[model samples]
Target: MPSEGEPHILAEIAERHARIGREQLALLRAIGRLDPEAPWVREGARDLPHLLAMRLGVSEWKARRWVAAARRLPELPGVAEALASGALSLDKVVELTRFATPRDEAGLIRWARHVSVWAIRRRGDLLERAPVREDRRAQRDRRAEWWFLQEERRFGLLAHLPAAEGAALAAAIERWAERVPAVPDEDGELPDLAARRADALVAMAQASLAAEDRADRPTVVVHTRLEPSGGPTPGAELERGPVLHPETARRLSCDARVQVVLEDGHGNALRVSPVRRFPPEWMLRQLRYRDRGCVFPGCGTTAFTVAHHLRHWSRGGPTELDNLALLCSFHHRLVHEDGWRLRRDGDVFAWLRPDGRPYRPGPPPPAPAGPPRPAPADRPRPALAAAAQARCAPGPAP
Candidate 1:
């Protein structure tokens, strides 16, 4: 809210400027059809150019461009339609109509709708550079492109690779599919190998990105609102992306990112903790060694497990080895969103319902023959041993 007497002049001027410019263009187009350069003796105007120069106070070059745009409108009616509809500007059409003709106007108009003016110029350059006669073999070669559009939440990919390259890609995906097989403690029916490979590919990309030190690396950040008596609205948003549902954001946070950022409602950072959202690698390794698998008793799933908060961060939960447990995505969601809850005692954790009904899984099946014993800790120092022996030695005087 603005304080009393505060003016929103900048916003008001910006809005009005756009409307006036569009209206001027529309009027110019209407007059362009009527033929501006009539040798009218009325009102002592020499001609349309003179009238425009003197009345509108525009330079001859800019006025000429606008006049040319009006003249060329008929030849590129598609671009003209967009201009009239206020979807495109006159300057853009003036430049685009230079490369595009009536024959290509339809396509250019569509491009103008989705792409920027600079992109239109780029396409023009590409078209100019294209060979007049394309090689038949090269034309037949496949292409690869991927897009994830945000508006409709749509994803698309088109791949055109040489046979050997295709085979190598397929083989790589197959190796991971065979290695991972399926997600442990899967909630519903499992997807096929193709789907699993797709997921594995995304996971591989994410892991690589997290390890990358390059600028523009992506991150997941969630903003939660402060308590009722305090500041900003509680909401979650993907960095540089759309607002996300709280549950979806929480699920993504399970990626175990090395950093967690806490923010106020106004999107100001309050604190940053590298080990808050994710435990350090050492802690995760310790967790894996101790928990062995999902702690949901009989569920003993070892693969595709994630560390979950015993006391959720939303309720002021702490992030530590003692406050965390390993569980697969299914069980994790159950513990977080569903009515099920978990109680942890050091390495052990158990699941229960709101009704106090405990669900403990049975003991895990026996391991395959003769697993190697884990290596032991280092030997004690000689001086420490001597001290222990002295403490144990009987005091004869006593």
Candidate 2:
């Protein structure tokens, strides 16, 4: 079926790909020759992987693989020769380097040429020898981190787990993903499997949070300015996280259990108020009974909803039923962080944008409303109460 020139074109493509592999081998040799300590130190990187990631604009994961392979190449001359001569692809070489020693590199090189990159990688994984020391190292290396890209206003997560635990977690996510319904785009095409997995992760988190007793839920504390300064307020800072935009702080405060810490301009604490950060269980039940779900014009999510204070508690607002509403996380952010506002006229609420235009004309008919089904009877609370008391017990003076 091939045209006369098709075979020639395909051969040329294969040759070019082989040339890329040779170039990669040269790069690895160059990396191996660099004084590993001096460059990373001068570049302010913790290790070769960090430096490579920053300089090459590669992912930390990829940088790590490259660094490991480069370190092994000098000892495995056969692998280096195969890659440099374009007999072995870079991907196959990288996987081989993971388990290859001087004695085994030649055999792996020959076997790798006949197999796919994934097969070689799987072989390397199975070849790994797990001794006690390696097990200890695995435990030591287990870590998870959250990194923020300030320019993109996004966060990235990286996690390294021991093989067994990682496999279990992956299985859980895959199973959850299977249960997640596919969401169609504007063109009616469903999201990809990866996106569905992300949705599954979020759903898992929601379920976990919902299972916790109200009194045992985690609290996030955001330190922010209530007093107006001469200039525009920059943003609110989290006690344990990065600085948050002002609007973000507002959105978080909507439903979060928060403590009010009053401080003077000089950063000296004036007082720490003991006001309840969130409504008591009884009050929350009343709120659910009243608002039913998110009060936003069209959003009616009932699960994982939070109580929003129409008049923020920090601004001398009372915590009475008249001042509270139920909102899901998304619409809550829309109001606090995204420049949307709500106006209450009797029992109805109106949505307004940052530019003061209405989201919909007048009061849209009330969102479909109903209280959540009654929960089971409460469990004994002594252990939880004790834990709370100990947690609130002031830490020893710094």
Clash-forming residue pairs, model 1: 225-234, 298-361
- Candidate 2 lDDT, 1-398, residue by residue in tens: 78999999999867655545555666677678766566443233446775665454455566677777888998998999898677887667778899988987777788888988888878877988878897786776666655457899976666778878888989999999999889899999998988898889889989998998546555667665545563434776777889888667666766666765555566566676563556777888899888867686544546558888888776777778888889876567667765678767799987776788766522322322342122332432232222322222112101
State the lDDT at 224 in candidate 1: 56
Show model 2 residue runs off by greater than 4 Å: 37-41, 131-159, 174-202, 212-398
Candidate 1, residue 1: lDDT:
83
- Residue 259 alpha-carbon offset, candidate 2, angstroms: 11
Local distance difference test, each candidate = 0.58, 0.68
TM-score for each candidate, following the candidate numbering: 0.34, 0.47
Q: Per-residue lDDT of 1-398 in model 1, one digit per residue for the tens?
A: 88654567766654444443344455446547656667522312335553443334343234544565667776677776666455666556655765788887887777777876677656665665445353443344435545456798977555656556778877877776676657644577777766888877776677778997656323565555564467545456666567766655666665455345667656678876654436567878888777767676444445568877677665577767788788866566666555577887654666686456876433323332442232332322223222222222112100
- The top-ranked prediction according to TM-score is 2
Instruction: List per-candidate RMSD values in Å.
Output: 33.8, 21.7
Q: Could you tell me the TM-score of candidate 2? A: 0.47
